[model samples]
Target chain A: SAVISQKPSRDICQRGTSLTIQCQVDSQVTMMFWYRQQPGQSLTLIATANQGSEATYESGFVIDKFPISRPNLTFSTLTVSNMSPEDSSIYLCSVEGQGAEQYFGPGTRLTVT
Target chain B: GESVGLHLPTLSVQEGDNSIINCAYSNSASDYFIWYKQESGKGPQFIIDIRSNMDKRQGQRVTVLLNKTVKHLSLQIAATQPGDSAVYFCAEIVLTGGGNKLTFGTGTQLKVEL
Candidate 1:
């Protein structure tokens, strides 16, 4: 099993502000991803964090709103910029394990007020 | 767009009884199907996974059954416990240009009654 950790387990941000959540894994991993879960909703993939390259965003997500940086195999950061009340959600980070299975870190709960 | 979906939004089961959660996926090209458990305020935890070639796979007390004919999947947990109470999601992975994109279902909230 992979031991994944995230910084700033939660935060309350004012509108137009930004928050950056960090993710760290115990060992090197091949793939890292970011996800969002709106209140009372299921998780949605935001982007795929690539090592030494810009992250790949999903169709509904954009880099400007949610910028991602994965400098190495074990660490990454997701910044939610210019936040609004609609941006209030739990942000999660996950690493791909063997056979396409993913292990997730404890999510960062963000509330934009 | 490919999508994975669940039949029921929530399921209630008695402790020690078996619990079954069902899912339906649209993409036939998916490489893997997986089950995940998410507790409140926590990220999803991998429960079990089955490959496309296999019809069923078991882990610990959990059994995952995949029916490609109907594009359906089901997870069976024997002797369900209170600890099993959480939101369950079934996801399908399709290898894309970026990586393995896991499309998740709406999820089923499992409530174990003691």
Candidate 2:
């Protein structure tokens, strides 16, 4: 199992502001991903953070809105740009562990007001 | 265009009894499936995973069963404990050019009553 951690476990920000959440893993991983969990909803994949390359985002998501940076194998950052009330959700960082099982960090809960 | 969905939104089970949560997927190309448990205010935690080549896989007290013919999946927890109460989600891994992406299903809330 891999140990993962996220910065600013939670934060409340004003609308139109941006917040960057950081995710760190204890060891190097080949695949790291950012996910969002809306209120009472299942997890949605936002983007796949690639080391030294631009992140691969899913449909309906764009880099302008959610920018991701994977500087190394053990660290990544996801920024929620121009936040809105709808963007108020838990942001999670996960690393694909052994046998395709993904291990997640304690998500960063963001509340936009 | 593809989706993973659960048959039930909520399940209530008595402690020490067996519990089963069901899921259905629309993508037949998906070859890997995983079960996750998310407690309130926390991220989804991996419980167990099963590959398409196998019909069943087991962890400590958890078992995952897959029926490819029906595109259905199930997670069975034996002797359900209070800690097992949480929202459970089943996700299918779709292999893409970028990497393996997980499409999660509508979660099922499991309530363990003593």
Residue lDDT tens for model 1, B1-114 = 111123437799999999999999989989899999987767889999999999999999999999999999999999999999888999999866667888898899898999
Residue A38 in model 2: shift from native, Å? 0.5
- Best-matching candidate per DockQ: 1
Cα lDDT of model 1 by residue, A1-113, tens digit: 79999999989999999999999999998689999988777789999988988888989999899999899899999999999999998899998886688899999989899
Those runs of model 2 whose alpha carbons end farther than 4 Å from true positions after fitting are: B1-8
Tell me the lDDT of model 2 at A89: 83
- Candidate DockQ values, in order, are 0.48, 0.45
Residue A2 displacement in candidate 1 (angstroms): 1.6
Model 1: residues with Cα > 4 Å off, grouped in runs = B1-8
- Across A1-113, the per-residue lDDT of candidate 2 in tens digits comes to 99999999999999999999999999998889999987777889999988989999989899999999999999999999999999988899999876667889999988899
> Candidate 2, residues B1-86: lDDT per residue as tens digits?
11112333889999999999999987999979999998776778888899988999999999999999999999999999999988
- Checking candidate 2 for backbone clashes, the offending pairs are none
| Model 1 chain A: ten consecutive residues of lowest lDDT | A94-103
Interface C-alpha RMSD per candidate, 1 decimal: 5.4, 5.3
